[model samples]
Each structure stands twice: as structure tokens, then as C-alpha cells.
Target chain A: MLILHCPHCDRMVDETDLHPGGEAHLKRHGPEADAEAFENYLFMRENPKGVHFERWRHVYGCGKWFLAARNTATLEVYGTYPAQTHQPPQTIRDTITERQPGWAWGDFR
Target chain B: MSEPVSALRGRATSGSVQVSDMGLQGMISLRCDLSFGKLKALSKDLVGAPVPALREAQVRNDRAALWMSPDELLFLMPHTEVDDALSRIAKAMKDQHHLALDVSDARALLRVEGPFAREVIAKLAPVDLHPDVFGPGQVLRTRLGQIAAAFWMTDAQTFQVICFRSVAHYAFDLLEASAKAGPVGHFPRGT
Candidate 1:
């Protein structure tokens, strides 16, 4: 079992529990979001071919969002970060924080 | 020779597009303290072996499948025997600081097996389905589509997937999509 460090939690978990959220740099606009907007947010995907930065959640455990760099072809993860501060994009950090979520998590459930 | 081969294989010997009506229809929620004595003995007796206090999954063939939590287990059985099992668990667990609940209506169980079942499991859930990673008698509390599912690998080719009755449709859709992708080539890739 591979344990990955989630930026938000600053910890590791068995790959079994964490849900891969695809690419995660979309900004949440308004309350009454439209179907097109929601579709773009949900269905539409970046599907990068190289080193890609994406958002993830410690869904089953911590509920925090993370910035993870992964290789698309090899499926090797390079690094991960918390949704806390603004960091300059690195060769590995591809997904910039467009509009950071108020909190990178829901609850500590 | 054809008769002999057919007889050797019963209804489902398993191959491409094989289907088995897995007739499991009940679930029981068991909350017992691993630190407790009576409950541990009862679990061992029922399983006919020592119940690992903290392992996630254990199986004893068709008789039962056991799961371990921090201090809980959810046992599934045939619908008709739910009450009997519950009472048995209760009687065995008396004088112990544990809770046993019959959550039969909380979730539904289905067995989806074939070469393609793991491919379907890869889409929404996150568990290592490879035999080396997820061996037989392993269980995981994960999601299937949007519904929470408890997955149990009963054997190399058979798996039991469970979810609340409400989101059964989504599970079916995901399974269909996985089948379309492949029988073995459909495992989940990294995001």
C-alpha cells in the first residue's frame, strides 16, 4: 500500500482512501451556477500529458484539498502541497491556484 | 466429452460474459470493543478461527465475511437469518460493552463477478484490486460512484460490492462503463 502525503493534512494515507479529483484549478464563480458552468467544472477535464499539478481531497479521513504533482504516463507522483499559500509555479507544479477555496476542506470527519 | 465438460462446470464456471445471481440480501452492523473479552470469543467461535482485532477483512467462505474497524464490524448474511444472527451475536455479546445493530435496510449487497468486474471497480473506487495488493478475504470501505460501498474480494474471480439501496443505479452505470472499457485493461489509472 502506497502512502501519499496530502498537502492539506500534511500527512500520509493508504492510496485506498484518497480520491483522485483530476485537475483542480477551476475557480468557483457564483452561487446559482449554470449547467454549462457546472459541466465545465465537472465533466470537462484537462487530462495533461506531462508533469501535471492537480487538486485532491482526503475525502474519507481529513477532507482537505491538496496540490499534487504527478506524471501522466508513468503515474509517478513527484510532489504535493497544501492549499494554503501562494507559491510560484515550478516545473512540477503545473496547476496554479486560480481561486483558492475558502477552506481546502469541509470538516474533520 | 461435451456432456462431461458441461457437468464438470456447473451453472457458472466463469468465462467471458458470465453471470451469477449472488443472492445476498442482508447486512448487520456490529460495534464491539476489541478490548472486550466475550465479544472476542464469540467472534472467534463464529468464524471458527481467531478474528484479527484490527484487520480490515477476513472471510470463511459462504458461511460469513468479517471486517475490522476501530471497534466495529458490519456482518452481512442472508435476509432470513438476520434476526437469528443478531440474536446470536447479542447473546454472545451480553455483559460486554458493545453495540450490535441490525442495519439490514441500510444497505443492499450484490455480487458482481467476471473477468470484467475489477475494471468496473476501478472507475469510482480507490482500492488496489491486483491480487498481490488485494488478496482474497480483503474488505475496504470505499465509494462506488457516489454511494459509499464496502468491497470484499471473495476470491480471484468473485467480488462482493455493497452500497445503500438508494444509489444502486449509479453503481450499475459505473459497472456498465467499466465493462465497455475492458475485462482486464479497464483498471483505474492515475489522475
Candidate 2:
């Protein structure tokens, strides 16, 4: 079973205890945005093979939503952080950079 | 309101494992920033003890507060004491971004005791029930046989499992089946 470190509970919980919430840090598109922007916000997602950022909920644990930075291919986890921030913490981005050189995700490169 | 009847009635126990409905107990879902000094003081005053930290529980007399999350606590007391507890908590948290709801009737409490208590629970729960890892005062929010449940180890041989009242019977059945199945070999340390 996949184990994920839940930042909220400060515990490494089993994957069965968590609920995957798809991609993380997506900018919301309101009525003011163009059709293309709205469609991208709703339907478009980055299914990259390398470094990726995603959202997960410790549903059966702390019941808090958190973000995880990991490599989709190698399953190497960079870090997990609270989901309150709109962007990943700089420390997490730096860790990803150190592990997977030249890797970029969203606004962090 | 009519007197609430237990979901399991008289059929909860099986073999060495005794699963009995705790009946109607006062339950309050409290949410607030515990880091706030005022809130922390208010919680101690309301629960008659300091609020529990993560994955921990603080017991004061007949009442106990279990930490459900960073910002949430589940307060347990006698059913008769719910009104007084809620009013006190609400007044103290007034104007704050806090929530205090009386969930006494919405849930059911099952007391599991005896030697095989942990083993029975381990059959259906994914949690590590090893005594060294999960001992007294520890609480966990998890699923038992497809039903959402929260439980706390009251002692080495006793666990109080709380689940939604709607699924009380279903939960009891699952617990009984697992209890009768006896201990499994999956747990390395054994209960």
C-alpha cells in the first residue's frame, strides 16, 4: 500500500486512508474570464510523466486537504504541504529542483 | 423528543469480545483555532480540562475531549449534560470563527473490551493496533468495514468506537463478525 505523509496530522498514513483530489494549485476561472480560460480551468490538467503537484485529503485521518510534490514516473515524493496556500512553498520547490534537476511545475521551475 | 433506543439493543456482544452500545452520550463537534490563547483557555474552562493535542485525548471526570483535527475536537459527556456544555462553549466562542454543534443524537458509541478487542478491530480496520504504537489516550479517525468510524483506546483492553447512528447496526454486525473470526496473523506483535 502507498503511504503518504499527511502534513496536517504529522503522520504517515496509508493510501486507503487518503482521498486523491487530482491536480493542485489550479487557478479558478470566474464569469469575468474568457471561455478558453474557463474551459482550461475546468477541463485541462497537466498529466506530466516527471515531477507533478497534486492534491490529496487525509480523509480518514485528519480530514485536512494537502498538496504533494512527487515524480509521476519514479514515485519519488519531494514533499507534502498544507493546502491553504495558493502556491507551493519555496522550500518544496527547491527540494524538487535538487532531486529532479530541470524539473518545473506550474509557476515553480 | 422521544427517548433514543440503542441501535444494537441487546445483541452486541460475542465470545470474549464485548461490544456494547454506550447508549446516548453527549457529543459536540467543536471547531476553532486551538492555537489562539483565548480559545485554548475557553476550551479548558468548557471541558474542565485542557484540550487534547493531535491524535490525543484528555479526560476530565466523566467527560473527554478527543482531538479530531488541528481545528476540530469531539467532546463527549453524559447525554443530560449536552445543553449546559453547548451553551457554555457557544458563549465563550461568541464572535469567533468557531462552530459548536450538539451531535449527541447523530452518533453511536460502541465499547469494545476483553483480550481480543484489538485483534477484532484489526480485522477490519487498517490502523496499526499494536500496543506500542496505539495505546491509551490515543484516538484515530478511520473506516471499519466500509463505514466511517472514530475510536479511542481508553485502556490496554478497551476501545470506544463511535460511528454515525444511521449505520450503528451495520457497524455492530461487522464488529461481531470480526470478533468471531478471532485474531488474524497479519498483526506481527499480536494483541
Number of the top candidate by TM-score? 2
Cα lDDT for residue B71, model 1? 57
Where in model 1 is the C-alpha error above 4 Å?
Answer: A1-109, B1-21, B45-49, B184-191
lDDT of 1 by residue, B70-185 (tens): 55676655566788877888788777777887766655555667765665575556555665566566666665666667777676666776666566555555655655565556
Q: Which stretches of candidate 2 lie over 4 Å from their true place?
A: B40-42, B185-191
Against the correct fold, how does model 1 do in TM-score?
A: 0.56
- DockQ, per model, reads 0.09, 0.73
Collision pairs in model 2: none
lDDT of 2 by residue, B54-127 (tens): 88887776678899999999999888888998888878878788889999888998988878788878778877
Q: CA shift at A25, candidate 1, in angstroms?
A: 28
Weakest 10 consecutive residues of candidate 1 chain B by summed lDDT = B2-11
Tens-place lDDT digits, model 2, residues A1-92: 56778888887787888899999999999989999999999999999999999999988877899999888999888889999988888898
Q: Chain A only: give the TM-score of model 2.
A: 0.94
Instruction: Specify the highest-DockQ model's number.
Output: 2
- Looking at candidate 2 chain A, the ten consecutive residues that score lowest on lDDT are A1-10
